[model samples]
Target chain A: MAERVMAEAVFDDLIHPSTRLSIVALLASADWADFAFVRDRLGLSDSALSKQFATLEDAGYVHIERPVTQHRRRVRVRLTDTGRRAFVGHVAALQEVISTAKLGARSD
Target chain B: MNGQVSESEARLALDAVEARRQQVAAEIDVPGWYWWSVAAGWVVLGALATFAPVWASAVGTVGFGALHAAVAPRVISGRRGSSRLSVRRDLVSRRVPFLVLGFLVAMVALTTAIALVLDADAARHPALLASGIVAALVVTGGPLLMSWVRRRAVRRLSA
Candidate 1:
């Protein structure tokens, strides 16, 4: 009836590219990683890792904890149950993209 | 154990501190262009069929039917660029709904098309309607489903 362009907006609910990569890598490989561990693996600065972790934590994809010793405070991070599920989902989405049979891909 | 009661306790202690850093994801919803692309594809096919039904029918196998079905799963989930589904079990578990949705939509679309072809006054035919409806439904409903599931999962994680 109406002549207009239609597009599927698949990027809406996704985590950022860098953040997602870091997240998936972290969630998929180890059950938990410390702030330092993630920072080292992702090659991110302290503030950068902090920013990313904050985002993930807010979205309920990660569980963040801080333990204080005699005086020093350290952070421990783990993939929440939701985070694990999201990681699984994220992997599936990637599979769909890679499914040439499903995508009519020409240049596989 | 020095600064905190124990490693576990310290870990627990840091929970709220790190969690408070979470911010609302700016790109936490599906995109829009993908919807328009599919719609455009269907409209083009409809136009082609109007001009030469036979030619459209032939190409439609690949372009209209196959191409659309091919990408439906990806679009429906609104996750276009994930890179970790190599593990078979992981892939299958998450895509159960997607595969099921694909089959259901195809069956429904085919049934509707067949009905239109058989009906005398179906007006405009069912091919166009079916394609457009499937695309729109998946684009809208798919994300809603994901959003609902994500919230549920988040709640579970919190517990």
Candidate 2:
């Protein structure tokens, strides 16, 4: 399918100190990843990852399914439909910013 | 870090860059005194190959391949680790991908050089010439790539 309009909202979405981008990039590389996996990959402290996850979940960008198996805390992370859209758009927005940043790089 | 950001980001960035630098160094695990000394051996081997073509090719192959294995890591490390500035550390920090790219380029150059050396007229082979040009360009283009990476790190560092 053709991409949706890569608008200004995507840029606005990225203007945050949140670890959300790390979450998106990590999830984008894999279909599903455990919290511990992300924690190690991003090297984020427990509280920082928790705070960012809360923000992202509140925004409907992520779907957290807590499937308990034998007393294990398995918080599996997957991008929601809205999340995939926002992430693709967000990446396109960043690409736009990079290409148009006037370091003489042309639009691809 | 600007003496403001948390200790973790600083460390993660360090891990990201160091992982690849370490790989580049590790890949070229070779003996001492063999890198600069190989050129003399190569000339003698190159002359011998005109008579015993097969033996010559084998010797030349082992000789140059060894030379590369001995020197590749050093060359890559010298370019990447030249800077001491903290800002540069950030640029090199997440450079595992670049190291992979460098490895790929090395493979391509090595194969092409081998083929060129095996040709009847080694000096006239385009593969050899092309590989030389590509290697030179990569060595020269390093600063340009670093400058681009440096620009990104500077932006991230601005916070």
Candidate 3:
């Protein structure tokens, strides 16, 4: 059944890590966010955020824009289509796991 | 047993996702500067309507509209915040502009109605009085109204 398949959904390790997951979740909610915004919100250092962004960008889950305006550089990030799909799947998988466990508990 | 443990972890992850989404949603608001500018404009327009000649008042209104049009894209997008984060487009309902516009129209109409009533009562500076009232609303009630509108929009869009 579809339920059985859903219950067996695979967890994406790339997105399962807490910091990455948090970043993806935040990005999933918006079209684009600035680098400083993401860093401040996540309470990550610039280098730490950059590292996470590099990981996601390498996976093609996010797109980063660096533009120079008024001689100042700014970075903006957005979840790519691939990233959004992956995030949706991950959430569904999480929900499935929870639901299946609840069902098992009830039956027992 | 493993399944149960995985399920617990999944539940935690799901909770985190929801929390992060909520945090993003909370951050989706027009900057304070935007609100302050709008409030100032409202007061100025009110003053013009009260004291200016008919042609001058008309010009002022048109000028205000033009200024609003110029500034609207930023304000109505509901993307910018006091912080560096811009809200994601998917989370923002397309109906936000319409809601804001409707609110503005209502405010204008209410202010005009108040001015008319005060003028009929021979109140001094009726336009200024009306503007004062509406300016107060803009300063105090603007955020609350935006919050209510945003909640309603999210609920409706989700449904």
What proportion of the real contacts between chains A and B does each prediction keep?
Answer: 0.00, 0.00, 0.70
lDDT at position B102, candidate 2: 70
Locate the minimum summed-lDDT window of 10 residues in model 3 chain A.
A1-10
Model 2: residue A78 alpha-carbon error in angstroms: 0.8
Off by over 4 Å in 2: A1-9, A14-18, A103-108, B1-159
Top-TM-score structure, candidate number: 3
Task: Tell me how candidate 1 scores on lDDT.
Answer: 0.48
RMSD, candidate 2, Å = 14.8
lDDT of model 1 at position A64: 78
Candidate 3 residue spans exceeding 4 A from truth: A1-10, B1-5, B150-159
DockQ for the candidate 1 complex?
0.03
DockQ (0 to 1) for model 3: 0.44
Error of 1 at B59 (Å): 1.0
Candidate 1 local lDDT, B38-123, one digit each (tens): 55665565455545668656786576667767866555443321221111122122543564466446645664665466445665
**For all the candidates, what are their Cα RMSDs to the real structure?**
19.2, 14.8, 4.4
lDDT accuracy of residue B117 in candidate 1: 63
